[model samples]
Target: MIEIENLRKEYARGGERVVACSVRELRIGRGEQVALRGRSGCGKTTLLNMIAGIVRPSSGRLAVAGTDLTPLGEAARDRFRGRHIGMVFQTFNLLQPFDALENVLLGAVFGGRDGRAAKSRAVELLEKVGLGDRLHHRPNELSVGQMQRVALCRALINGPELILADEPLGNQDPETGAEVLRMLLEIAREEDRTVVMVTHDPESARFMQREIDLTTLRDGEVAA
Candidate 1:
């Protein structure tokens, strides 16, 4: 569940304030899958980051799963995000030195789970994503699709209530992208998790229960 009211994010550039994203009101129900559609620089990613608590809004309210992120400090937000939100980034963001299982275990550890249980969950997730045999492989040793699957497992390892994916399929070929998206949606639905994905592709948007055009929520000029 996500609720937003007069949410606006701005950045200072060239000594002038520039709006990054603005949404007057938006609500997403629990267990819903929504796609945020927009062109480059239209604030899709900005909105996702704000919801993930990676970026603080300049004004207005943002509540995810009943927690108002607008008033929380960075440390508090980080802890909350770790425990309640799962993020799948386009870039994968996996540490090169850590193996696939380690990357996922780190997520559970960050969420304050016990080590043995975390490892078991990580292994289960990796197996669910068809990466059971690749647990010892580092990021560089895996293919693009495999890397993304690993990232997906990492995101789900903590059993987050909300999953935020930014350009999840941006880098893969059509076939691989479709497979990844299918797996993501299927997993989310099976787990009864709420998902909000940022994407510019119309075909990708069709997979979600609802598609929201970010430009429609704009209040002023937005930066790319």
Candidate 2:
């Protein structure tokens, strides 16, 4: 499970402190799919980055899978996050030179495990996402939907309990976006992993079990 309490993020922008995200509380459980829906400047990405431990919170508590990551030193936090959290960026974040299979395998290596089992898992996931035939294709050769599936496989390669996806289908056409959304939820259900995603599309919000609007930043805190 993931527990976020009184989470606040303040940064020095120019000369004054700026609040990117100020959340009173939010909790996500295993096998649950939650979507954060809001406008562009509402801090969804900031919240996701905090969960990934890439950005530190100015004050508050964030615990994922029993680990309190808010206080860990930078290096320790990085290692802990690599072990417990897997993120799928809107950009796919694939290596330009690596093939699909190799790219998925690369994610597993970052999870700090031997690459062999991860490679095998990647194959199974690719097949699960209906991309078995394109295992060796490079990003340049794959369709937008295909690339998103490849990203999904990479995110799950490390066997993370919590999957954080930021606009998982942002760049795809309507048809491809719908397909990606379905596949994401299905895979999350089959694997019994927790998923929290942020998307701007209203249609996408309806697909989630529950939707939280971040547009109303209240009491100097956000809630779902």
Candidate 3:
């Protein structure tokens, strides 16, 4: 589902070059779940953002679902991401003014889908995530866990083929984090979508089928 070759990101800091991340080659197959594990400043989130097309690589190629992201313009990348990728961020990034269901519908709406059918899909996703009774609640009315669940629903409402989660469980307690991870994996498997998650917790990483330790990769190398 994802392929990267000679991926590298660098920055100019204090008149010196800083390598944020570099991956010589990497491939994540369809319907697979892979966890990217590394310490701070190891480029875990940098790589995730690159895959999401939110950040451009300084060099090399990144392809998702057969489309090379490197050459795509900003607008094209935005459309590509909205169409094929679902991202779950650590912040939950919900809309405060909108209710839970409305928030979920935003996912489909931004993906160029709207109307009754989109609403139905949003409702189904929210209910599936155990938010049926809380559908009318706004972001402020929900707990942290509830808010994250809503975020998950929002990410899946568009039926994306790839899911990118950046520190999905970093805010929750151990039990809640574990539960969320389980729900995420279960839903991804049921939908037959691939997942690439960035996580610090090894226990959480274990839930994925494969693990990529960024520290082990050379400055310009990525493990397959």
Candidate 4:
């Protein structure tokens, strides 16, 4: 679940404060799958980052899963995010040096799980994503789609209650992207996880239970 009120994020650029995202009020229920839509530079990704606690807000309030992130320090936010949120970044964000299995295991470790006990789950996720034969491959050794699947596995290895995905299907071909999104939603439905995804594609938006146009919540100010 997510709740926001008068939330705004601004960045100092060219000696002036530029608003990145502003939402007067928004609420997403538990187990909901929502798609966030907006034009380029409209702050869709910024909103997702704020909800994940990776970016701090300049003003207003944000609460995810009953915890208010506005007052939490970076360290505390990191701990809370690790425990409650899973993120699928547009860039994949996989460490180049770590193999696929190691990359997924790192996610579990970051979430405070024991690496030894997490290995089986990591392998299972990789296998589920059709990466069983590439478990020992590094990022450079895999294709773009493969790397994306690995990132998905890492996000799910922690069994997070909320998943925040920014352009999750941005890099893959149509078939691969559809497959990836299908797996994500199927797993979320089975586990009862809340999902908020930013997407530009209309077909992708159709998969969500609800669609939100970020521009509609901007309150007359343009996002940078």
- The estimated TM-scores of all candidates read 0.92, 0.87, 0.89, 0.95
Q: How far is candidate 2 from the true structure (C-alpha RMSD, Å)?
A: 2.9
Give the per-residue Cα lDDT of candidate 1 at 216. 84
Provide the clash count, candidate 2: 3
lDDT of each: 0.88, 0.82, 0.86, 0.91
| Tens digit of per-residue lDDT, candidate 1, span 1-224 | 89999999988988888888999999999999999887778788789999999999999999999898998999999998988999988788999999999999888888888588889989988887678899999999999878888888888888899999888787667776787788788988998999998887788889999999888888755564
How does residue 34 of candidate 3 score in lDDT?
A: 94
Query: What's the lDDT for candidate 2?
Result: 0.82
Off by over 4 Å in 4: none
lDDT for 51 (candidate 1): 96
- Candidate 3 has its poorest 10 consecutive residues by lDDT at 215-224
Per-residue CA lDDT of model 4 for 1-224, tens digit only, reads 99999999999888788899999999999999999998788788889899999999999999999999999999999999999999988788999999999999989989989666699999988887778999999999999889988988999988999998888788778887887888899999999999998888889889899999998889788744
| Cα lDDT of model 2 by residue, 120-155, tens digit | 888998887778899989999998778877897888
Top TM-score model = 4
Q: How accurate locally is residue 86 in candidate 3, as Cα lDDT from 0 to 100?
A: 92
| Overall local distance difference test of candidate 1 | 0.88
